[model samples]
Target: MQDNLPIRKIIHVDMDAFYASVEQMDNPELKGKPIAVGGGGARGVVSAASYEARKFGVRSALSGAQARRNCPELIFVKPRFDRYHEISKQIRAIFYDYTDLVEPLSLDEAYLDVTQNKKGNPSASLIAKEIRERIFKEVGLTASAGISINKFVAKVASDYNKPNGQKTVNPEEVLAFLEALDIRKFYGVGKVTTEKMYQLGIFTGKDLKQKSLEYLDTNFGKSGRFYYYIVRGIHTSEVRPKRTRKSLAAERTFNENLSSEIFMLEKLEHIAQEVSRRLTKSKVSGKTITLKIKYSDFTLQTRSKTLPYFISDKSIILETAKDLLFQEKLQNSVRLLGISLSNLNTEKTKKKLEEKKAVSVQLQFEF
Candidate 1:
């Protein structure tokens, strides 16, 4: 996809608290209160929780009981997948009004390559905002947008202003914005890498850029090139709307059956560093961080942490994995451990004005 001279104009549309917001929009009385979708049974999981629920630590994937514990006044609702999908289809159809390079990630999100938009509008951000407005007026939903020169920055920028808020990442300011960013916030750094970066004096974009390619290559091998590229805002990665992820993780299975906290931590840290490096080299980030452990009896325990944000940093990845590890009950001597990353990154678009199409990150995530 990168071989051509096609500098594609792409947009990523993400529904805000999609399921919860849908419930709230459908029932005005549910607005402004803690709401969670999906609480039918023991196996029932929270599909989406409102901002109010978020304040109480209620979140998607949490058991119904856990969510109630987090927020006593939380209101639970069932998922309307069919309805949500219908809304998604309606939103995607709107994309067709602009371009055919539309790729749907799910019922709540999609990436549209509007480089040669059908409307010939010349402004992806304009298209993004218009789409949001259309979704609200037609489908009765709210969305957030992020527009930028590339899919990576655009998708990241979308989250900056969410729940109907819009933000733009201008080409001239992309560098400074990235420079001031925390190392952990980078698309591929992961949790372990973030901590290591802290230990190695790499806290921000400037620190990451300061590290010579030789140093990064020596330490991180293939990802060294990517590190340099992103720091300079020189990414050449293409946005293929139809791409799916492969090999989501790279971790180690401990060689010995031991449980020394410090030692185990060191081992996980090393694994996270390797994984982060690999992710950057591959130009990917996983929203799910999985932890695998096997006991001396050959019994296995696995845990996963799904992030609201797509990340590729080792430190964040490791931290989440570590938390998952602690969440589980260990019954025997630790003999093995593994880590994997999933829910990879994809293209996203934003709402932008026609004149600001050159480079703009949609800051629209307000509800």
Candidate 2:
């Protein structure tokens, strides 16, 4: 642990194959069977897969056809978002019984700051155990957890013992635990970043720590500094109870590819209206507008423009989207179109600025 930073007890709870688990729970016939939640068509993708399917190398984001090829007995079930949300609410209610400082990452996972919890239990490990037990007993579903001194470490630890298990990284073991971990195991390091890290000879956390901050910055830009600090156990992100919205978007996938620009323009107008309605409902406006285009070949491209002022009006959004659409030529027939607004007028952005400034100041006094 860094000398200047105070220790915090954070717990990350992730449900076991949440979407597929819900389907199995509702239908006894699906229990112990390989199942996937999504359409089984040429354009369909898997949202979630049961453990049985995962054993056959079937996973989320895989094409439905590929999933079936991987597991010939894979059962396809349509997703029931409303039912999932209902169960998620019940699980959150259980979390509140122990700590009000719950920050949900998604419907299936959350981080709880148990340093000062309602339970007043000194052991975060015990609290995590009790919470998981209650969730399983009440909801008839299992969850995994990772308890540590910060959000990043806790999040990574939660995956160590998955499918109804937990792992706690004590303060004394923090440095060693990180040093031995595979570079791919780091929370924010995805496939592309992992390949980049491998090319840089960074195979483990220890290898990453040996690189100078400047070297990382030169290679990974803003994210380089993030990797430098996180490897040294210096992540300071807090569990925000009400996580602010960063962006809002609306998109549509056509039943058939549209080749004409005029047809695409008409589709963009409706997407802009949906984005405008969403912004108004959230009572927030944004200065940045982005147009997303997906070709029939499944290639994606985006164009963005930032205005001097925020806007929530459909007319402005449509005009901006139209300008972007015309700015580029159609590379192939269009299969999907989307519009999004960012740089939102929210407290999260302001808080991030303040946090960045504080970190800069702290760096001068620390290593």
Candidate 3:
């Protein structure tokens, strides 16, 4: 099977500081300045940071307070998802013109399979160039592209020359490139995993390739096999055109912690309602309801239960979340509450149920 595998032309495109860039593009006053797109409160987190802010060691998911400490001049702007979604659609349209096999990881990045493209472009690198140019010309934002034989290498290469650049790694250079890559830079290798890999004497791809599959499996479980193949530039995962939504969730943090159970329950009710609203809007329902609690001390706990039937109603979600919440004793003052629904009903299943209900209603009218 390995010998029969055909080389594919894959490109990964990533928008540079997408939200911040969009904000700057619309608001001329924000140009050439450090800005963060998110709430700038004590408990708020940065969603995206301008390149200028990044130089100050600011980054997405970093605490707003810390981002402020890094760059005092940093401007904070609220995220406009509607505008971002519109931009994303424009970018995706460009991708579809090149290849229908476009897999969006998020609003800011996507992978494209241009092995057999709509434009009949032989060179994936050229396709990537055109896409980037079109994005800038049409969308008024710059994107970086990485072209390679596979998605993993392409994703890593795209980051090599960022903001407004592109990189292509030929098949012959794949091994050499992977060998020099820092394990920390490998996709899916988070900070915790990187630290674990370092402790196990795997700091770079070279070090990772030195280990046996058995050794890796023993150390890292199933993901060990993934690392084993990826280091050899042997990733076989295709660029899936459709990625399923596995869950829906909503959460909120309070300005002040609440020690009373009644206060916590009230907050949980609100979170549940939000989650249900999202689920309804998405036309999804789930059997599993999870309750997440974050204490004032920053400790977190989650409790979940799976119901026999799928439900997206707010009352049911609220009740289930309340049950999950009460099942666990409060260890500390609650600072945040969250609810998520999983074990989702597929779109086909939802549609079938809707059709069945329609049929039942028609039968009642005939009587």
Candidate 4:
């Protein structure tokens, strides 16, 4: 079975508590102590927590007040996104030194396909180790890595050993490793799906593999096919080198919910401007504009408009957002307002240019 599988070397690299670790690395006093990166305010949520903070049950998305309750000594440091981006670029440079087939999942993690690495090294595990060492030595941050035959197992393996460590799942070990893995740990399976799987008596990869293709499809839909193959260690998704941004967005959660429609419209204007600025900075526009609203009671709603053409103009975005905002009556007092642009034109321009070049080449040949 292993001999029939196509050979590929995939590595998933994830930084250990990225934001909090960066804080500790820069501040001498924060080392060896529990720290969190976010505002420690009434409505503030923890963005990242150091391992020390994690020991006390403080974690990302936990409210700042709750995080403090978890660890009385937890220190909150405001996030430095600019600094993090700088460090992320440095880490990517290291990845590029090894392989151009690097797919960044976020500012702190990425997938690297080193089957044909620039370093001419055949061992993916060794390349992962070298990448981690370079990141620590150059950027003063530690990264954990998972090496496997495919991205699914590689991503799962990466988290098996966290905080400055690496794990490798060789082709021969893929089946055994996946069979023993908890069903909840399967990629793309979330909380609701896990509960559903448990109700269906699917508790592990072995149990999942026992389900027929038609049975999985009937139960889980299209994702059932994903599970069907992934359980057998078959994932053919390649590491995309230039993954385009699907959307550009900006949103704000207010300190106080506003009941006034005027206030909401005013907030939407600012949000639209922010989204437009991001679209311009990214040099991409989109046809779909979505307005996300979160009410005081925490219930969320979204309204969207897909235009005939892509646009990054702030005025147009603001007008469209205003239309969406006023088109519906207020469901409740709003606490958060967000504007996002999607269905981006990142590849459209490239495709158009390629067509123009093709026409030019054809004309030259005719002459």
The best candidate in terms of TM-score:
4
For each candidate, what TM-score against the reference?
0.62, 0.88, 0.92, 0.93
Q: In lDDT terms, how accurate is model 4?
A: 0.92
Candidate 3 error regions (>4 Å): 348-367
For model 4, how does the per-residue alpha-carbon lDDT over 1-367 read when each residue is reduced to its tens digit?
2467678999999999999998999998999999999978887889999999999999998989999899999999999999999989999999999988999999999999999999899999999999999999999899999999989999999999897899999998999999999998888999999999999999999999899999989999999899899999988889999887789999988878889778877788888888988898888998999999989898999999999998999999999999898888989998889999998888865687689999999999995
**Candidate no. 3 TM-score:** 0.92
Alpha carbon deviation, residue 27, candidate 2 (Å): 2.1
lDDT of 3 at 339: 92
For candidate 3, lDDT tens digit of each residue in 1-367?
1446679999999999999999999999999999999978998889999999999999998989999999999999999999999999999999999889999999989999999999998999999999999999999999999999889999999999997999999988888899999998898899999999989889999999999999999999999999999888898889999887889999998877889878787788788889988998898899999888889898989999999999999999998888887786799998888899998987756778899999999999995
> In terms of lDDT, which candidate is strongest?
2
lDDT of 1 at 157: 77
Clashes of each: 54, 0, 0, 0
Query: Residue 273 CA error for candidate 3 (Å)?
Result: 2.2
How displaced is residue 174 in candidate 4, in Å? 0.4
Candidates 2 and 3, the one with greater TM-score: 3
- Per-candidate Cα lDDT values, in order, are 0.77, 0.94, 0.91, 0.92
List the candidate 4 regions with Cα displacement exceeding 4 Å. 1-5, 348-367
